[model samples]
Target chain A: MHKDRLVAVAFTLWAVLVTGAFLQANGAYLFGKLLERLGR
Target chain B: MLAFAVTAALILALAGLGRPLAWRLGTCRNGQHLTEAELWALAPLLGALPLAVLVQVVGAWRYDPLSMAVTLAVALLPALAFLRLRPFVPVLPWWPWGWMLAVLVGLMAVSALAPPLDHDSIRYHLTLPRRDLELGRIGLWFGWSIYEFFPPLTALLTRLAYALGGAAAAQMLNVFWVVMAALWAGLLARRLGLGPQGAMAAALLFVSQRVVLNLGAAVTTDIPLAAFIGAFAAVAVAGTEGARRALLLGLLLGAAMATKYQGIVAAVAMMTPLAVLALLRRRGLPALILAGSVALLVLSPILLRNFWITGNPVFPTAHPLFGADNLDIFAPFTQAMAARSVVPGGLAALPWTMFILQDAFDGLQFGFPILLLGLPFAFFRHQGGRALCLVGIVIYTLVWWGAMPHLLRFLQPIFVPLAALAAAGLVEVAVVGRRIGWFRPVFAASVGVAIGIQALFAGSSALYRLPVALGLADIRSALEVPAFQYYGLITPCLWLQDNLRPGERYVAVINDPSVYCPQAPTLHPLGAGEAARFYSRGGLPALSAAQVAEMLRGGNVRYVLVANNPGTDDETYAFAKHRFDAVLLPILRQQKPLVDSASGKIYDALAVLAALESGIGAAEPASGR
Candidate 1:
């Protein structure tokens, strides 16, 4: 992979880890509420 | 409506008062003035200094409306004379403005218009100010709360707002600090040689954060401390030279320290690098000294007051060093907080834990990820202010981790520098995107989505409370809802306000939420360290029913408020059950409570005492009702 592409891939993985962790820990409840409200 | 209006007026007044001082200090040695963004950012903070000082001075005399109005008039006369109006212009792009407006409106609807419901706000932030106003002086509320010994700057400011309008206005004042912090973050970004776009990104990122949105518009020291810390960073990083810069830096440092104890950690973190850098240059030594001196001068009032009362410059912290008595009464509470550290893997696991297990650390999650994502990128490029911000963040995080990493809220100051560095990182990512076509859209989409998620959360939270803010629903009725019923003392306080006669006092036991009962005089017997002095002996449970009754009678307490359910599993309850409940429960059974709800039960002190004397209901078990 090109250096820039490698950097991009690593950054994408880090973002996923962070976002996933957030959702699992705290954001899931709020997000669930948001989704439920939208469903209603 | 009146609260919003009063808050707006106070913001303008503070800006007016601070403008002259900010201008004088904002001028660079080369004769160029700081950008308007920088000047305006510094204005409210600079303006708040004199007002805070005035509050302390007037507090010695009395905190009545007459005294407050007279002092304010005297101070504002000069401020009004120096006030200069400038045409309002929007410097940032429309997108940043839209996000800021949405956040601001949401905060106003959710927090500013509603009665204070946050634990710390009711416990001390608004409570202490209300207590001082009621007492007609700012004397030592020694047994009332340990927070009385904390820095009084924000409390002083809150008192001013509370005096002017009410608790709602005091709550609304925090909105000003939020905006000021955002603006200061933008100023710091600009100082870092990040272009206007980067500045907007920094500011928007800051305001849209979960922590900022959650704590915004509540009467808390966190936002004000962040604002002052941001202002300090912005000024410290400016290319200004000599005494003027020193003076401005000192004032800001002092303000930060005066806002909260964590301010001391922030100052040490940021200033250590600046001092070392200055020493390396040799010529900057005198300027550093001048700044240090000014900071001490600004912090002296709080120091002197604490030393005078408790023989400790920073009371409740360094108790053994200063021989500050009675603080040991709170050791169990403090120890419980220490034991509650949820960062499982310690220092090595901090970064992951801070970002991932935020609930364990007792904070909302969105802010840390962007910081984690962007800060590393900030170091890749040779940005002007990047080195300073990076060092500050590193030192601050390390110190915070060592001291109290469990409390994510204490890390509020680091957000100022972290936001700047993260914005730089985002800018760097954009630079990379220029070479790769697909990367550009991805970058935009990511940033947009992150900010959108934050705004959505903030807007929804605000929507829940929109009826109260819009005056469509009564605040009391709203507070009675199950969500707020646990900590919201409004319902019980309303009952007390109606029932308690003049010259009557209520003793609150294991209930710290009596702050809402400003109309009635209330005392925290267990909270005030009196339990340690009178009830406990030989580290064993020695409390008796007669002793508790006598303490109440001696204090002229007519009512007794006991926590039936403290909402959370509190150490105080655990400790009290062993030592206090056995004695008090028997007495409480004798009297029909004046008010009983989920929050607590309030009993007639006279009836309880009569029952105690008559030996009625003596066989009631130690188990609490």
Candidate 2:
């Protein structure tokens, strides 16, 4: 309920959003390449 | 392995040469010596500019291996006097060291195993230097591309690397720049009064960025430019008010300018505030003047060369001021770039779009979201140099947004200062959050997750090239692998190198990767646009087969290398389809190519032209009807 806690919560949410977006964008391609290489 | 050894030797030599100079300049105004970390970080940064200038001087005379060796020996001989200065031993915690080791190994593997094959490197970075080595002098090859007029500092440095240990060596040399940039980031964080952990975090954040990982090992100017810009920021933020500091700042700025044109923007961003502050205080004016003059001295070679060749000190830019006609060849490509106007969602949306839709800018996903997330938290701490770092980032980004192309890589230099701020913010937030229950754990977990994802991406990218790096497979074999086709026109270029006789000239069309072709290929800058504009004159469609053949003969071009698929949506294909297909393709189709594959076709230009001339003569009487 404190302002500092609220700030921390907001930052945490932003970090999660960013991390999710990055993974969503690049995770599939990276994993696919790894799989392809492993198969090879 | 030889390439790696040569690159390492070069880096140590540079560090040795720079140590005393950095020591002199980095000592605080109050007579305090630099920390070991700061000195080691500053040494290579100080050393590289002078060596780059030395290479330019030697290159201007002649860029032979013997001359380069002699120049290097002369430079190293003086540095030997500073042997008493001990070797740098980084005193970092285990985790940071682990991350650094991983990144370094991955980067070195990629750089040491591969020849320079990235698009920009092949196009000009390595190609220009290769041409200089061939010609035995660093004269302007105006016929190649407009990029020839750009600052040749990094190219000159690459030339030394190329002369010593070949293309792989030059690539390995670029990895040094990446390391230097990361080191400067850490040093900047330290100057901002961050603890050792925060400094290491800043360095790791910078090195782990996808953009850095992607281009870190490539023989390109961006990484080196970033290093110089970062070094300048670190020095500027030290609050050392003396002539030596000013000189150091000037040299770094000059080196950055010589590395890339965007350095001009960086210089303006850094100096504008300092100049204004100094003017208000009525002190430091003389120091500023000394710094400005020294920077100009460092940059004068490129400016003079451009002025001599194009009548524009900064050619390709300020064309309107000079009214120079040399850039006419670049008009179509330049116009196409202008039409793209790459800033999507306008200036207001740049912050959102730059991070979210990074692909829209240049197809390279650059910068981490953690950087954006951590940026605001730096303001909460009210740290010593936070205000300065924030101002530099803001000014640099604003200028880049307005004046420069919206490519993510151009904004790379700003990442050094931004990473410092971000690291400071994260560290500060964690320190503050310890008072609140549950905040520290949640924050730590989120930060860890973000960094872990980035590391995974970086590691995966590096892992793909590990086989060639570990010598399990030959580099040639790796080049032929379909999965590694983005290594540019290696197969076709090697085929040309093997086939083309000495003294025979080839013309590379559509995609020019002539750095790989040793037989002196004439490059049509970005496909057939410049070729259509120059050789065909009015248009390829307007010119007859005889005229085209005559033009080819006039240029003494014997072979034609054409990429069949140059990506239709890009400007290369658009220009080729509009102008090249009209006249050149039909003539080229008449001849059986010397080499043909999925990559492209290589034709005997003389044969193609000969057939065209004879066919035109044969059809003249029939056309009389």
Candidate 3:
């Protein structure tokens, strides 16, 4: 609930969410998944 | 060697001179003192860029040793006097001994000795400056290559190197900037309140990133830009508000801008946070204006030069504004690689794709490991430090994703701050664990282990290449790696340099340009668009190949370095893009090459493209029919 904690949450979500999605498409998952993600 | 020594002295002297300039600005105060390392890291760029521009303004791109020696000899006066006057104690915690173990110093020495083999180095990084040295003045000789117009801060240093010892020496200057960047990284960590060990870890992590490791020996605008931007960020983060602090900020930002256009974006990113803090204190505009003015002081010369030469202020981009027809080469080349940038579903998928899904060798090659794993630490606590670094990373990352995600090295500037923040994160954890009794040893060990791993990664790269970089190994074989691995062949270029007469001019009919500068007068034949339009389309305008060769002869080309480099070298094959070069392939196949490499052939331009009479005849007109 503190302002600092809120700031931390916002930043962490941005880095991890965007970074996590990119990780999967970049060859993290199976080739099929990568292809599927790429197609979408 | 004398020129190099003089240049070193000149850099130190400039640092000495900059101290006063910084003092006079009186911008930073109340906990804004610069570390010894930070000051040293930033000093050379501060000194060299302005002096290099001065030399250029006088139309002296000849880079003659005497000119440099005399100029620097005068510069040494104040520098020595200043050094003698200011004997200060170092405040660093002694934890970065790992630099020696990594043979970091040795890597710099060796790579400097090894020939420059990076793609950009050969193509235009070296070639543009090399041509100017030949002509004895600074001017845009490579009209087809748009890289000529980008800021020349790094290239100015390259000019000095070329003037001193030729291409290899020019490129070797990167070794200096590499060390500067690492030192800045570690010191920046220290400023963020990380311990000496954490600072060292930060520096080690910075060096461990494969691109950073590789780029030191290879000349590109990236490494120097990293050093300058890192230096700028260091000053911005550690120093408090004052006239002097603002001036130092301006100087570093200007130096960064002088190195690459990214400096402008980075300057804005760096200033926004500080300006806000000042505004919160109810006095922001003066600081902002001072910082902006100092940055412009360093940056304006390059812009003036561009405006004079290109008519458009930011050349090729604002072609519509300038109303210059078709001065747009860089934009198209960038657009060609656009698909690789998009995260399929776009921002929604960027995180996963940039890190794990993308090819290991492609953009963001070191993706988000050290950077992302430590993200929570960056954001969690130390609100002041966390916010400073986070704002930069988020802004640059979003911008990078939106516009130019496919190109990886551009991420270097952003990564420096991120890496520092990551180091800060670990340091925080290490500090907290000590107070927690039972968890103390485990946390300490983890921190040590992580730092050790990064140091090992950094060390092994330097040690592996130590011999080659130092010229202990067969440098000739090492230099043979084409700047563009898929396209160029090195042996034929070596053969041309070894066998061709001195002072001869070479027309390289392929993608790589590294070899041409060291050997002879050089010309890269076509721009990126010209290549794509001609080769990817599968044919040249019915103009015969020999006619183009005739054009070369008139331009005084003695030999042509010809390689296939088309569908053979790159993967993005929506189209073929080596038309002018491919046109040379048939001509090469028909000849007994003067010599050959694994992937290329070298032929006497006079003999291969023409015997006496025949050349590519102009296409017959339909009207003739």
Among these predictions, the greatest TM-score belongs to 1
For residues B1-625, write the lDDT of model 2, one tens digit per residue: 7677767767776877787788887775665456777777778777877787788788889888899888777767656755775565776764853466465546655645665535676666777778777788876654355677888777777888888878888888888887788778888888888878888888877877777777776777878888887878777777536778887888889888988888888887877777777898898878887888888988898899888765678876755466522324444555666576566678788776677666567654554577877878888766647787777777988987766656677788788888888888888777767877778788878777766667665765566456666667665665555633533556677788787776666665554454776634452333333432432224334556676666678767777777664333232322223233345677776778888765567788878777777888899999998
Per-residue lDDT tens digits for candidate 1, residues B1-625, read: 7777767767766877788898898887675467776786788899898888887788778887688767666656655654455555755565754467555645654567776756677666877777788888877754344677888787787888888778888888887787778777777888887887788778777776777776676788888888898888888787435789889989998899898888888988888888888788876878877887888898888899888775668875655565433344345565776677556787898877886777667656454366676767776667657898778878998988776535787788877877877887877777777787777777776666576667676765575556676778876776666666555667667777788878788765544554677522764445355433321223434656666667667768888767655324343422222334566676677678888876667888888777775553453443334
Best by DockQ: 2
| Model 1's DockQ score | 0.45
Point out where model 1 deviates above 4 Å.
A1-10, A24-27, A32-40, B31-33, B82-90, B96-106, B324-330, B365-368, B472-477, B480-486, B523-543, B551-556, B566-582, B616-625
Ranking by TM-score: 1, 2, 3
lDDT of 3 by residue, B560-623 (tens): 7766464343322212224356466666667777776655767888786564225333333442
* Residue pairs clashing, model 2: B510-B527
Q: Give the Cα error of residue B112 in candidate 2, in Å.
A: 3.4
lDDT of 2: 0.71
Q: How much is B617 displaced in model 2, in angstroms? A: 0.9
**Candidates sorted by lDDT, best first:** 1, 2, 3
